[model samples]
Target: MAVSARRGAPLTLEEISSVALRLIDEGGMEGLSMRKLAAELNVNPMSLYHHVASKEALIGLICATAAHHVQLPPDDGSPWQEQLRELALAYYRHVRAHQSLWTYLQNHPEAVADRQMSIWQALYRILRLAGVPESELRRTSDVLHAFVTGFVVAETRGHLPDDPDEISRDFDTAIRLIIHGLAGFSS
Candidate 1:
């Protein structure tokens, strides 16, 4: 069944965010236009503006919301390796699921400071747990984050070839290799 929007009432911020997110999910960031969003919501484009300040702000909110979807596991009982793996897989799935978002996220310089701190912090913790020196933790986290995010961005743009199981398997291999290498460095 299709839903229609009324011209009388404007969409809420959440509603606008949902519609925008859906648009990005369906098409890349370029696919998310105010007119397209309004059409999807079955409302006048002007009404959307009432809720979202502008297209840029709307995109920012969507990025923030997606960033919130990231989950970090408890550190007490779980091994750092397991936690990092889960986080990486979660990040991978998120990127694949919202490939459009990756396009916007990559180009936005403020993205790291603005909405992606949770992801960076988690990776930072994992690197620290690996006994990596504190001086290098931030730098290491940046490198590791870039590695995965770059992979996602390339994949999203179709720059990277698609292989059904390749992402997870290759990531798993890479993480294991890195951890093994870290162990040697520690010892």
Candidate 2:
């Protein structure tokens, strides 16, 4: 259904984010502008400001909304390594599903720098379960985050094979290395 702010009804942030995400998914961040979003929602360009202060804020809103959609692994008695692997794979799928948004986020560090992001928080929990010291949490998370994201970045940029099975094997190996490396921190 088409959303419209034309019938004396207000546009919800969810509506704005949904339409904005569709736009980014269609043409990437470059194609997303207040004017374009307004046109998509059938609202005045200035009306967007009521829900989001600026384009940056709108992107941030979308990021947060999308982040919530990522399925973090369940905390049931599963080993942390397994849970971590699940989390990594889920995140990988999310990135692949939203390549354009992920690319935009990769370019704009501030957009994904929120410490409260679901992915970051999930990683931190898994790392702590893996026995990383509190003092080393941030550093450790950064290293692991860089490793996985770097691999995805390379793959998305065509540095890796295009075969899905090959890519899955490569990512599986990477995750194993990460899990093995974490074993050293085991007390």
Candidate 3:
């Protein structure tokens, strides 16, 4: 039973990514061993090397997929404040959906992937939509991201004990607070 006898064709990158994502979902980033992933896909580990190269590359692909999910919609007629709020919420949703991987990313993103560039690009889009200058955008973006990540981590741990909906309400309140604070910047 040789590898060629199984499929007679190489697994495409998309297929590899899908399977890897499944492995990550089932078992957090730490559990995604190359051997286990290969076993799950019924493919040889060597075959994976041809597609992903390493676990870090696979993680990067996963992060990119997550980042794409939060890409902002076209400007349309939405107000900049509305756009910022939406962007923040969308990013929070992504972190919640991938909570375990998100923690892994926060701790060791460099080890897992080359995801920073794509993530920054996405954030830049949101900031530009909000009319934020590049110089101010970086710091403002960092604070917003810290807030989203911290909020997600806090929510998952049941940090706020009030109404279950309090989390969403609190997040909305936070967005409004930041917008008010930045109002004096004049663009």
Q: Which stretches of candidate 3 lie above 4 Å from their native place?
A: 1-4, 111-119, 162-164
Q: Evaluate model 1: give its TM-score.
A: 0.78
Q: If both were scored by TM-score, which would come out higher, candidate 1 or candidate 2?
A: 2
Per-residue lDDT of 1-74 in model 1, one digit per residue for the tens?
12235645546677778778888888777788999988887887777666667888887778767777777665
Per-residue accuracy of model 3 over 1-187 as CA lDDT, tens digit each: 2343466766666666667666776778866888987777777787778767688888777666657667564567776677677777777677766777788888984654442565566667766766677788878877876776777777777886547588789888888986776565654
**Residue 105 Cα positional deviation in candidate 2, in Å, after optimal superposition:** 1.6
Instruction: Give model 2's TM-score versus the native structure.
Output: 0.93
**Candidate 2 residue-wise lDDT, 27-132, digit = tens:** 9888799999998888888888888989999999999998998999977878999999999999999889888999888789898799888888888888889999
C-alpha TM-scores of all predictions = 0.78, 0.93, 0.82
Give the local distance difference test score of model 1: 0.73
For every candidate in turn, the CA RMSD to the true structure comes to 4.2, 2.5, 3.1
Q: List the residue pairs that clash in candidate 3.
A: none
In candidate 2, which residue pairs clash? none
